[model samples]
Target: MARAPRIEIARGTTFDQLMLWLDDMLAAFAHLPPDKHGTP
Candidate 1:
């Protein structure tokens, strides 16, 4: 069986910092090619 990855955030992280991080992550995925099987 496989375990889900754990994500940890710093104690003092601000909302703006979190948003910027999310935007970066989304932008990173924007370049990915679509799945041929139509499944995520």
Candidate 2:
């Protein structure tokens, strides 16, 4: 059997921080214009 990757979080992290990070990433992606260069 293969072992799963181990994940760890800092003790002081909060839910609000996680949500804020996600929002920031989504906002960045939303601002990008559609790809007019070529068909993928």
Model 2: per-residue Cα lDDT over 1-40, one tens digit each: 9987653336666889878878887887776765843324
Global local distance difference test of model 2: 0.67
Highest lDDT: which candidate? 1
**Regions more than 4 Å wrong, model 2:** 1-11, 36-40
Give the alpha-carbon lDDT of every model: 0.73, 0.67
Worst 10 residues of 1 by lDDT: 31-40
TM-score of 1: 0.56
Model 2 has a clash total of: 0
- The TM-scores of all predictions, comma-separated, are 0.56, 0.54
TM-score of 2: 0.54
